[model samples]
Target chain A: MSDQPTPTFISLDDAAAMTEGTRVTFIPGLQALYSEALKNVCFVKGISLTRALHPPMGIDKETGEDRQARLFELTSQTSLPTMFHDDERPRNVWIEQLALAERVGSPSAPALIPDDVAQRVEMFGLCAVILGEDGMVWNMRIMNDGPLSRKYGYNKTASAAAPAKVAEVIALIDARLKTQAENGSAYLVGDAVSAADIYWATMSMCVTATPPDIMPVTAQNQGMLKFFASNAKVPAIAEVLTPRIEEHQHYILKTYCETPAVLGGDPL
Target chain B: MSDQPTPTFISLDDAAAMTEGTRVTFIPGLQALYSEALKNVCFVKGISLTRALHPPMGIDKETGEDRQARLFELTSQTSLPTMFHDDERPRNVWIEQLALAERVGSPSAPALIPDDVAQRVEMFGLCAVILGEDGMVWNMRIMNDGPLSRKYGYNKTASAAAPAKVAEVIALIDARLKTQAENGSAYLVGDAVSAADIYWATMSMCVTATPPDIMPVTAQNQGMLKFFASNAKVPAIAEVLTPRIEEHQHYILKTYCETPAVLGGDPL
Candidate 1:
């Protein structure tokens, strides 16, 4: 690899524009995991089929039906986030989610991702919704057609990550953390911040803001903007959150993840 | 028994009707549960406020402002749901929320909303979502407002229950059920379907058909609802659900819940 790394993505859109694939999911293994802002989840889950595909409902190029048919099918399934059937959980999400379980023997274990082999086994029991659309591909594409979803489009197909699912995921994490939170801890997995916490800190960017240089959105996250624009307390949380978020991004996740190729060089 | 059963409602020129009370919440417990349709949540919620208030927003004398404002405040904590805080969550909603958690018992207890508990207690976690608001005398006022809430125009308040959070809730629940579902158990809760299942079932109303009888409107539920109609799927779910839901006349909740007039003789 060259020392300069020949920065690949000039802009966020440039990365999304590289769409060469038929299906795109949240960056594999990099889904977010926060539990605090459950009340403010609206801000995090701004990505969705409706918001992404607001105006135009296209027709599938394949079956030749209203594109919404598949979109709704996938959207409904996804809306409930059936990423994996109880019997057919997508290995991709299940495997990654399982990584969070208490694993034993694995060197990666005890790194806030679980060290208990039993917990690891139970992860198969954990739900990590899927989005594969010979049925769904069209609607996500339509989301890209919108000015809003297009603004944050991703994957080679430049498909818009369904904001609805994103929010649902945050709520899932929040639900997972309610007990943890009832005890009073901002983090998810372990005593400190776990992969779940780090994940939320990272993914919230799709809805909220990240460093201008990183997420590089022209706007601060959407629903958050609408909220804090009117409400006062939320902005206070942002102030405390934004910088610590950077710390987690740098010190925690940065240790594992690479900069998205769509964005630029290797992980920052 | 008095001849009058169906409660009264207040109307607005711009939107749907409201309950006798000025305050209202279109959340799962109150409106969506009874209606079995998410399309008219805003309107149904509006009915609560209308019935409570002497006048509706922009239409009549202002009476329900306090209720509306407080109800808004309770669910307005962070816009993030207390439960299920994943960043991958969806937007348009149905159910499975955690943000507005109601304290039932121990966190390690595994289950939520035990069947033996009273309705308010069973749904206590969700009901607590309203605690943040002022429910003193207004609780009764809210109770009384049901008839007025169901009449003219409401459906615009927009609860914390967004479309995205609904998706995340379903996905998470689906994930939770993976093992059992694989085991051939169809329900999410116990052998039959508990409040948890009922909540999801009620929330799924977001996907149900909102006939005109329930969501009476000036402009209509949507431009072309025939294509979007949920059909028997919506009613079918209602059949398996608790008897609490009243599809036609909302007086069950209005008289029994809001005012104790037994407008629908809900057997409370």
Candidate 2:
């Protein structure tokens, strides 16, 4: 770890040079929880990542091409975080990233995926719901758009249905946490920390911001927090973002999330 | 009651002449459940109606104008089942129709809107959910459109969320029914039949087709029944359209809905 307090974010041009080692394409912001979580997983596994820049919603100034288009060329999908590992298949989704973490992790490191088959099934099922097209994040994006913009993008019926859909998933997660509490298990699946817990804790980074040390809270992230906080006005949204859920997320972060890796540009 | 088995559908021109009594503007079809239910209300009230034709999805050949445009001119809205009573204000919505039924119903007829305020509130709330934009019907419409057409109408996120939204409302209705069953009340609200029962029964017309004698099932209606029935493949939709719900709808039609009126036209 460098003595420097701030991490500097590297440009895509700089990142393009590193093809031999672990390379990750990510945007540094509260919204980039999936990317950050993946980075955290790599850190825990003692895998060093050469951080790459991913611009938000526009063309990259240096490249003069759509940043998203470049990202698509790198990884088949546009959404971050995109990972490249020395002549290996590029990993785009969080699940694939988690699998990679487990494969290369140091022998002393704890397994993120459960050893038991039934527990693995349950954990993966919940993760699918969280990451799937019809899952929490997708549904939240639908609800996030303002009513007018939502109508044009989503049909009248879909605009009408978005909130309830988000609520249902939130309720599912909340219920799982409640059950875990009742069973005296602090983690999402079984008694130990798993990818399910990490994924959930990080996914809610915007909704419930982690501490400044683990994930820096910036002005942009503040805006995200407000966006998530506003959802609390909706009763169903409020029900799932309960104290218990927040406590569980914080607990996972405290136990598993180590000192933030210095991925170079001024600590996001 | 007349022994005539054949049901007569009225023409627009003939129905137009009678302004002295209850006047209903409706098209004869399974889709015209709202209008049909209102007509049934009038029949039970012993209030004679001059049934008029409302053309489906196109211009009226006789008027040389859009049938829906004409309806909008008359009622400020194009949705079917518009009603005009003498010089009284036109009643377009189910709520207005229910109010009209209560005001003009015969002394011998059972009340549709419950007298109790709490019961009325509960009934209306449920009705709003069923009929509102986020309700089962609207969500069903969203899901009903083909995937290609849906892209233009609704965005990806909204499209994905539609099924769950429909499911939530279905679950709500199912839960209410379960509670009612536990309490030994066949009706949705209090013991006796109310607008809630009639409205739900009518709304679920496609889900559970009415008997041949009461609501003649046309080819389109049969298709609609199939559409609704197919939704049973989804567990949430299947839960609402349960055997108990079907039985309840049939009970309402048999007990409350009476003889088909002779408004003078070929059977629809």
Candidate 3:
């Protein structure tokens, strides 16, 4: 076999082969990484990093160090998830991979993550982590648990962290992405697409759908929409996700969303 | 002839092609843009831009936005191009482009520079700008006149005020690329290559050659090497740019240093 054309490891990057084995650039498959006693699974650790770059912990380019020092004091008091540990169990593989990458110097570069870029990358990494940790499992969760959570979920909201307003979430994403598209700057920056864009895009699929026309879309939305609608999920969930959260939403809507619908499949 | 297919625009990614133009992307053509005069270039102006973000400015992750603030202030202090025109020569097209990009919003977003991926895009853009500005013509002057005097050259020493120590410049770029490569982070940030990496690679080539084995060797080197070796340059330029000073000299010596001698075409 070694002499005769050994099968080289090749990761597919196309629409049809959704299989986890396929090396989806910028996308990782959680199920493939998990087996029987799946522990130490890490995901969404960076979702909040973007916001973290805003105040004290994050250096404000305008005010200088004094503002950073003060911001640090404020953030220190708050219970923020600078580094989030997904779920009750630890996904050993991710930890091992991270360690191995660290040892091999193949993990993402911490230095490359300049102050601003770090915040953006961390947030995006979290999005990737979540997608990798759960993959379609998230879709299943939304399909199965979403409606039940939404229909009976009502509680008194108090304090500042009263969960993000769903509508605001959508609008925020819309505004950022719209600017990104308009400015021709990939992410929030000049010409590069930061982790924020990727994270938003990935996590976003959990809430909304990619546009079909210029992005990754498929023939799956019909039934998928019905499934999501019937389950109805959390109102916040619906409120947070909308039609054009990211320019790529159209792509997802067109590609992945439609696949299941054409196949007459449901979230389950 | 008119119907010769609407000439689809493809993305060129090859280092050389991207430096100039290829299939999928059209960059490195900043020189061409200068010749073509891209009008009304809508752009996004980023507030907290940095070196990894903008090669022209170098890195500035400091909390005190003093440096960038000064840069902004300098621009504000004087009109575009420092308004030192002799009331005759038509404005420098390259400067016009830069000013135009800033005016229209930066031709792109808030985070115009992406967080991670390939580092070549920004470098690529800057290369275009440098080429567009006919930086070589000025560099040639830097070689002959040093960093002083008007007849010394055209265009402010791009980095005139903040001239990098030859060794420091070399070390900085080498370290930047090496660190990124070691991390498997595409050596640049974004969905693809950034102009920053291209700038480093090209500039580095001007100073020294790498191990042909390590770096894909091409005949384009001879012309480039000869250009730098010409006594018509900076003493620091020659000293720092010599083959002996090359960080990858051994890599080149042991691998591809002389391999190009056997090749035919120019080391473009």
Candidate 4:
């Protein structure tokens, strides 16, 4: 119900052409969890970001080689959620982008990293565990990717271990949320919302199926979401993904993030 | 095998009572991948470490409460491969422990972290992907833990997704190793053996079953190894666990680490 203007999605050419201000190139479809998390951080911090769609890295038909996007020239990696601010080095890593958002955002906004040393350490550690290299979403990605790849008859096979790992991560988050609730805090790390909360709220899309009313996606993306949800319904994941976790995602999106997520030009 | 002295495993009480140099408490039996990695780091660095068996945290019969070990009080965590050096804070995290080894280790030893900034980043990033929270072994651990738990009729259920994740990690390692080999480097990162090499070499135990002759474990552990190996033989894992990966483990243990491994009371 917030009246925030819909984020305008621009072409990769326009994004690369503009050498001023903060520009973020993100993949706009179902696999937009990382992009969404970064956008939500900017949203909470009131940091203006020029949104651009990541160019597809498809094979070059004539050359018989892989086509490299202009984005790859800017950042060696060909991944979404890459941020470029002013003349600074492009930030492809999630933590670095979060740090950038914190650095340039409005001073009046809630701090993503807590002031207290202990809370800061806890926040960083939890964020790393949730969003870092081998963190929760990373594992969930493996779990989901394996089945998706196999279903398409790709050479890739699924890991029998990913679901349990996903479950373990869910259990950890649920337990943390429960403890925070018990301590009279609505957020993940401390009293106010932090990067951990945003990361969890958006990344939960990897596991939980968000209805169209809350997060509208194209029909193709809807099928993808269904696939992810079905894969996530294993006993290991099911046993720990408590209702509270889902509610927290809803609360974070409704209160802090742009509701009815304006991803990939979905109508407001 | 090198004539290096067998590492004497001390009792938990003796280890706790020691007020001395570097002391490492590790789970002795089958679940010793973490311990093995830490121990190998010390071995490569030629740092003397007093080995201690971590006290089990089983439930008490009369109180029906989970018994807390002295280790838990020191580190606030109930896991293996906890390192204590002098009066410094106990290190429960893998990266922290690696840093400790790098700090107190011999200068003559092959540096685990690369000297060049780019190589260092690659090494750390790869190490994280392998040993970090959701890295390779972590996913494999989930893969292995699921079936083991289910087999025992524990409250846990297996994730249908873990095996593919395990395979993906294996493919990553295999590809890295292959690239390194093709580039004429014997190790994972650069020309020298770095922490990345050691981590991949030891952590591969989670996926590849080491024979009793190479690394002697208890008879009970042998059974557990069998269970792990059987679970790890899925199509996903099988497709990627190339011979090169297995050979690297043997080479590291034989050339760098003390072998046959002097774990628990198993005579060398």
Task: Give the lowest summed-lDDT range of ten residues in model 3 chain A.
Answer: A36-45
True contacts kept of each: 0.00, 0.00, 0.00, 0.00
TM-scores of the candidates are 0.28, 0.46, 0.24, 0.50
After superposition, which runs of candidate 3 have C-alpha atoms over 4 Å from their true positions? A1-168, A186-190, A193-195, A209-243, A252-268, B1-268
Q: In model 1, where do residues sit more than 4 Å from their true spots?
A: A1-57, A60-64, A74-82, A87-190, A194-196, A207-243, A255-268, B1-44, B47-257, B261-268
C-alpha lDDT (0 to 100) for residue B161 of candidate 2: 69
Per-residue lDDT over B1-268 for candidate 3, one digit per residue giving the tens place of the 0 to 100 score = 1111111222111211222211111112121122212211121232121101101232457653333333232222111121111111112223233332333343444322333212212332333323322233334434433322233333455435212333334434455446655766443344333323333333444444334442333343434345544532545444445332354334322331222222222223
- Residue-level lDDT of model 1, residues B1-268, one tens digit each, is 2233444332221122221222222221123232232212222222222222112122224553443332222221111111111222222222223211212123443233332212212232232211111111112112212443222111333222222322333333445456445767544433333333434433433444444433332222242233224322333323333222233124222321222221121111
Tens digits of lDDT, candidate 2, A70-178:
5554443456677777655566656557766776778788787775533554565566556544455656667645642352245556656767766665667788789
lDDT, residue B128, model 2: 51
Off by over 4 Å in 2: A1-4, A13-17, A29-31, A59-64, A146-156, A209-215, A259-268, B1-268
- Give one digit per residue, the lDDT tens place, for model 2 in B102-198: 7777888887766543355456556655553335565666765564225224555665666776666556666677789899988888888777777
Cα lDDT, model 1, residue A102? 21
> TM-score for model 4?
0.50
Give the DockQ (2 decimals) of all models: 0.02, 0.01, 0.01, 0.02
Q: How many backbone clashes does candidate 3 have?
A: 99
**Could you report the Cα RMSD, in angstroms, for every candidate shown?**
20.1, 16.9, 23.5, 22.0
Q: Candidate 2 versus the native: TM-score?
A: 0.46
